[model samples]
Target: MTASFAAPRYIVDGGTEATSVLRRLARAGWTTREGFALPENTWDVSGTRLVLFGRVADADTAELAVLAAARGAGVVAIADAGSDVGRALYADLARVGPVSVDPDAPVAGESDEPASSGPQLAPEQRALLERLAGGETIAAAAAAEFLSLRTANRRIAEAREVLGVRTTREAVLAYLRIRRETREG
Candidate 1:
C-alpha cells in the first residue's frame, strides 16, 4: 500500500496579505508554495487541502465561514495580525485546526515587527519562503509551490502591503533597504 501526503494549508487575510507572503517566500528561496484566499464558497472546492485566507476584514465572520467550509475539507487557517480581528480569530480557529498569525503582517497600520515575526509558519508558507530565499522565479516559485499564477500575484500584493509600497518592485526595494540598514547598523 502507498501512502499519500497532504499539502500544507493556509488562510491568509486578503489579496495584499497573500502577495506579501508569496513575495517574501520567493525572495527567501522556498519552493512548492501554494495558498488561497478564505473565500467561503469557492475555497472548499479549490482542490488543495491547504488554503490561505489573506487579510479578512471581519475575523469573526471569516472564522465562522472557514470553520463551516472546512468541515470536511481539512484546511488549516492562517491569519494576519495586521487586522485587529486576527488575535481573537486565531484562538478560536486553533480549536478546529492549526492557526497562526503574522505580527509583521501588513494590513493598514500593523506594528513595526519584522515580516518574519509572529506565530509559527504554516506548512505552505514555510515552503514558499524557503524557495523564495533560494531565488526561484515568481512563476517557478508558484508552480514549484503548487500555487496558481493568480494566487502568486495576490501574494506579491500582500508583500507590497506589508512594506507600505504599491508594487512588488517597490516592496522588494523596501525589503532591501531594511537589510542594508541592518547591515550598516
Candidate 2:
C-alpha cells in the first residue's frame, strides 16, 4: 500500500524572489498562487497557507495573522532583521502562536542542467538572465522582481549550473545563445 499527501497550498506576495522561491517550493511539493490582496470575508482558508515575503502596505498584518490562526493554517513572514515593523510583527504574531518569522534568511537554489546536450530555461529564469544581459546587477535584477539579494544570487548560481557554465558571465552568454536559437528556430 502507498500513502499520498496533498501538496501544501500557498498564497504569496512580494517580488521576483518571492515568486521564484514559491516556484521552487512548489516543485518541491507545495501548491502555490499569487495573492496580493487580503482574503475576502467569504474566502475560505480551510486548507491553504500564506507567506508574506515582505511588508504589505494595504492589509492589516495582525488581523490576517489572527484569522490564519483561527483557521488552523500556518503563516510565514520574511522581513529584514533590523526593521522595526518586522520585529513588531514577529513579536505580535508570536503572541498569536501560529506564525513564524524568518529574518533575512537567504532563499534560492542552483538550476541544474538537463541531461540532453542543450540547455533550456524556464520563462522566469530566462527573464532573470535577460535582466543580467541588460546590464542589471544581480541585486538590481532581483529587486525589479521583488526578490532579496541572497535569493537573486542563488538564482544566478542556479542559472550557471543549468547552462553548464562556471561564471555569471558565461551564464549570460549561454542564455543569449539559447535565446537566439529559440528565436531563429
Candidate 3:
C-alpha cells in the first residue's frame, strides 16, 4: 500500500530573529504557525508532520521541541543557534536522530587553550567527549554514539580520571581545550 504523509506544519516564534527565519522558511514553501505558548502534551501539537522552527527561548519551548521530535516531527531552531538553549535542544533532538542546523550558525562559545600538555583519549572516548563538549548530556551523547548510557557514563568517568578531572563538565572542557590546542598548533 502507498504510504500517506501529513502536510508539514511549521512553528515559529515571535522574536525578530525567529521571525526572519520563519520568513525564509515560508519563502521556501512552508506553511507557518505561531507558537505562542508551548503545548502541555504531544497531542496538542495537532499535526503529524510538524517542523518547529525558530529560537527556543525558554524551557517550555524547548520541551515543546522535544515533544514534537519525540513524536517523530522534524524540529529546527534557527535563531538561537549558538546559545545554551539551542545546544540543549539540538542535543535532545540528536538523541532521537540527526537534526539540521543553519550552515552559518555559531557555536555556543569559543575556546583558546593551548594543546596536549594533557593525556590523550581513545577514539571512542574522544567521540563521546566531543559530543558532551557540543552541549549533549551524558545519556544523550551516549545515545548519539550508539552506546548504552551505562557504557557512556563509564567511559566519561574513565576520561575524567585520565584527564585529572572530577566532573563531566570538567572532562568536556578539558577535552575541548586539548582539541583547540591541537587545531591551533
Candidate 4:
C-alpha cells in the first residue's frame, strides 16, 4: 500500500475539548491518531510515538519556535504558559535521538478465500454444529477450539450448503433427518 503523510497531533486537556478538536479536524478533512486526553493532562501519542504538546501558559514563545523547526523529526513539544515539563520534553527530544517518520503499512490477517472448494464438513465441524444446536453458544464453541467467530460461522454456513438448507434452523432439521435415517439403517 502507498504511504500517506503523517496526521497532525492534538493533545486536549479534556474529553469535551478533545471531541471539539476532533470535530473541527473532521470538518477540515484532517485525519487523527488515536489518543485520549484527561483533565489536567493531554497526550497525543500514537503507536509509541509522541507528537506534540500545547499549554495555556507561557510568557515566551521562543522555545516553541525552536521545537517547530524540528517538525521534520516527527516529534515536537510545546510547554504551556508556565509548564516546566513542556520545556523538558522539548529539550529531551532535541538531544535524545533522531526521529524518522515511516509510512504506515497494511495489516496482514487471514486471507478471505473460501476455506475449501465445496460444501464439505469435517467431523469436527459437524460436531460443533451439533453442539450449537444443543444449546451451546457460538462464542463458546469457537473459544473451545480457539477458532475465530468468522471461522465458526463459515463452518456452519458450509454445513447449511451441504444439507441444501438456507438457514441454520433448516440445517439443523436436515441434519436430524439424516441422523435418524442412519440410525434406522
Best by lDDT: 3
C-alpha lDDT (0 to 100) for residue 39 of candidate 3? 57
Looking at model 2, the pairs that clash are 15-145, 15-146, 16-145, 16-146, 17-147, 110-158, 111-158
Model 3, span 42-79: residue lDDT tens: 44343433445555777778877677656655455543
Question: Residue-wise lDDT of candidate 2 within 142-177, one digit each (tens)?
Answer: 888666787667767777887888999999999888
TM-score of 1: 0.33
TM-score of each: 0.33, 0.39, 0.40, 0.34
lDDT of 3: 0.59
lDDT score for candidate 4 against the true structure: 0.44
lDDT of 1 by residue, 1-185 (tens): 01132222335655565566555443433232233234465533324333333334475566654564344233334455455666555444533333334523332112345444323333333344446556776788789865777666565655555556786556555655655565676
Relative to the unseen true structure, what is the Cα RMSD of model 4? 20.5
After superposition, candidate 2 runs with Cα above 4 Å error? 1-117
Position 67, candidate 3: lDDT: 70
Q: Ranking under lDDT, best-scoring first?
A: 3, 2, 1, 4
Count backbone overlaps in model 1.
Answer: 48
Q: Name the regions of candidate 1 deviating beyond 4 angstroms.
A: 1-65, 68-134, 176-185
Ranked by TM-score, the better of candidates 1 and 4 is: 4
Clashes counted in candidate 3 amount to: 0
TM-score of 4: 0.34
Our model 2 lands, by Cα RMSD against the true structure, at 13.0
Error of 1 at 33 (Å): 31
Q: By TM-score, how accurate is candidate 3?
A: 0.40
